[model samples]
Target: MIPSILPTYNRAPLSFVKGEGVWLQTEDGRRYLDLGAGIAVNALGHANPDLVDALTTQANALWHVSNLYQIPAQQKLADALVERTFADTCFFTNSGTEAMELVVKMARKYWHDQGQPERTRILTFEGAFHGRSSAAIAAVGTEKMTKGFGPLLSGFTQLPWGDHEALREAAAQADVGAILIEPVQGEGGIRPVPDQCLKGLRDLCDDIGALLIFDEVQCGMGRTGKLFAHEWAGVTPDIMMVAKGIGGGFPLGAVLATEAAAACMVAGTHGSTYGGNPLACAVGAKVMEIVASEDFLDGVRARSGRLRQGLEGLVASHPEVFEGVRGTGLMLGLKCKGAPADLVQAGYAEGVLTVPAADNVVRLLPPLNIAEAEIDEALSRLDRVAARVGSDAG
Candidate 1:
């Protein structure tokens, strides 16, 4: 029996001893195809050669250095991020939740610095999963995540997901300082915001002078066949939070913003001790080098089509089990008409791994460099799982 840890996670029974490429191995040596990719963190797959090399090299060198001194690796990673994206400035963090907290603070500070102290209300969409922190829970406001947590943070204003009129009206409020949204809602059920909706929000934010923020923690880092999900909509956010795939599973997150938007965060206004540590930055730099390549992104787009077609075929064969498939690129979700958790368990038993999300959706987050044959193999296992579950339901 496993040791009793905290009751935070309702974990599956299986645990892997090791992993490589798209396969995980149990201690007893049973192999399983990993489609969840550690909930979209392993962009380069488990035990990737480049990532292993970077981590080992950095481990031999310096590990921790306080933020008081200038770190070259941190500066290098920040420069690369700024060059490739709309962000003119970058602030590092240890996790996506921390990055989001910094973004909220930056948003409020922006208005305050501009002499509009009352412009502190931040508008967020319903069904959003910012994080688990107090500020994040307040921004998300989901009953499951916020039920026992008393007295939610004061500055957040929750709006319905994808409601244009409500969002516009909220933006028109003089007290509204910023609008935060996930370009693709991950935990809220892998829903991609319509491009037209994003464009409208950008126009509205511009008109009302409210900063637009995208929580790209789950959908960014080439997971959506692009470096950032907002690129598909052609609308740039004033501030964006990215994590999960940013470090290729090394616990790194960042808040990127245009200089003007981040100008409010002056010295000593906010900071983190291990935010830009050398080891995390070195690994992050290597991850960016590999993921930001044209060939890697092209392969991601090509493989995404393969996975989508296979899922579509699976849905066609087992319509009673699955309602449909949604989402873009590698961050796809299957809408399960039957029990999603049951299907996930069935997949695990069939030597495959999948993740369940809200709205009864099963998420498939394969590695960014997954081969076509691996996609076919995963689909075969999914087909078997679907057939078994469908027969049981019948």
Candidate 2:
């Protein structure tokens, strides 16, 4: 039978009936190590006890109260986020795409309210994946995702990634209002923007009066062993988009911004029907609570070092298959010399799940709280899969 859902995902012939921590269980009772963590959404892992309790508690008490009135859970979540990050205000949404919609609009609105309405041009880099929204496709405008999806949304400028000279030159343009970037491009293949480069971009944006937006939708929420990925570079964005792990697998997203950047976004100017609902806010607040602690984050860093070392060893032992490992914390990618898809398929046979990206990279995004034993298992699976891939390619 044909599926009812649209053919959007190139899904594998795998159906997981249940999951806990870093493992998934198929209906036939086969177990698989889940390194993708639902593409970095299951920050604390599937069916997390605390998250379940939070959702259940809210569900019984209140679910959806319209944004027409106050929602205390939403306020508490907003306050928690504001207290820890560079943002002075937090606006909730349903997904990364919605968060991005607000982000682009907020940037443009910032300039418009200041009487520079023509400053709508935003600078985006190559291989950037914001979301499938119209604004997102328009921002990238690349053949990969934006193909046949036009007359594309205008007012975006594309630039080569990591070209500092070009970055400065683009920022200096009169019509530019913002530069949107990911601190570590996840879908673009776990590419981490160097610290100095991020610093340079910050300075350029500050000098040119353009707002800096970090789309941390994939790399935030303690996935990078920090509250947000940009914190590693010690660079802050004027506006930040967060999702995925912040909801800990729930479909909740948020747009965070400096007080100055959000000044024009009055109550009536923007809102969501289901966003900031009591149910989602309660769950998100619980996620933020668990992920925002110093001790928890330190564990993430320790695990990251362990995982990175294991991956490096795999790269050394399988030179024909892998180049190196990239990315930070539990969010990592293995650069393969051959097709990443091939490696991913081979991984399935090894009873491991992974995510594929461009640049022939396979992503490994285990839950932030994955155990040392699970890390060892993932490394063993990678070792076996790498050997199989290398042999098959021969």
Candidate 3:
């Protein structure tokens, strides 16, 4: 029998009823350390007081005065993003998938307005996940993402990850209008693109007159110890998709673009009814105010270093289970010798939670504001989980 909700996800058996900071309380009252942070959505941790206050305050004042009229909260968030990053304008959305839709449309529309309508193709890389939307699935072009969805949206070319030669060859083509990639692949196993590679992508886009797009939905909002992962490379994308932590668990996403890139979007090119509602933008603004600060980012970097070092030591102590540690800031991943799902299951046994990603990796995306003591506790719990997994394997 089909469940009340769609059974699309292979959900874990655990049922969490409440969350506070980096911990979740199961329905039966068991507490579990949340290292995944709701897949990086709860950047400030579950039920962050500031975010809760912002949402409640905005909810009491106003909730849904759609894009039909001006919204102050939306304007405030847009201003903050513009001041903090490279965007000249921002379009809000309800999720990363909606942001992806705008990114594709904006990139192509720029060329169309410039009298180059044929330059419609956008280049993406393997192991790239933009979103699950038709355009996003088409952009990835992987059999895993596009198998059943046929007659997919055209004009996206998939390239091998880190293949500069192939990237050069593809970008040189006349029809290529843009290049989209995740600065650090979250679902592709928390792989960080080298700084030089990001710089090279920027140079390549400049040379070919193609826009550069970054999908920062998973690695932005200070998850990478920088405001955005691309900032570590000191390069800026012409268009960027941002979400996840930006709302501090509330659903909000945005497509930020340079004025030149967004010139063609005019008034009716794209929009959403529930996108930028007062409740969402209020929470997002608060998240931005906190996460974009130097003090907060410094804390994130410090915690990231400690977590990374601990993960390395953990891997060394349990070589039979773990292979290595990779990723930046709080978005770390543990490469497993066997299926990462097994490690995730072991984490459950140890009253810890992790997210399993591609390439046999168990992701550890704890709250960016996780305290030092919490870090130590998380490491201790992870050590126990590793020991149990290793013993079982032996």
- Could you give candidate 3's per-residue lDDT for residues 1-394 as a string of tens digits? 8999999899999998999999999888999999999899999999999999999999999989789999999999999999999999999999999999999899988999999999999999899898899999999888888898899999989999878898889898999999999999999999999999999999989998999999999999999999999999999999999999999999999999999999899988888999998999999999999999999999999999999998999999999998899999999999999999888998888899999999999999999999999999999999999998888899
* Full-model lDDT, candidate 1: 0.93
Alpha carbon lDDT at 225, candidate 2: 94
lDDT of 2 by residue, 83-129 (tens): 99999999999999999999988998999999999999999999899
For candidate 1, lDDT tens digit of each residue in 1-394? 6667867888899989999999999999999999999999999999999999998898898889889999999999999999999999999999999998899899999998999999999999888899999999988787888899989888888999877788877787889989898999999899999999889889988989999999999999999999999999998999999999999989999999999999889899999999989998998999999899988999999999999999999999998899999999999999999768999999978999999999999999999999999999999999999998999999
lDDT of each structure?
0.93, 0.93, 0.94
Error of 3 at 86 (Å): 0.6
Backbone clash pairs for candidate 1 read none
lDDT of 1 at 186: 91
Candidate 2 global CA lDDT score = 0.93
lDDT of 1 at 187: 90
Model 3 has an lDDT value of 0.94
Single out the weakest 10-residue window by summed lDDT for candidate 2. Answer: 162-171
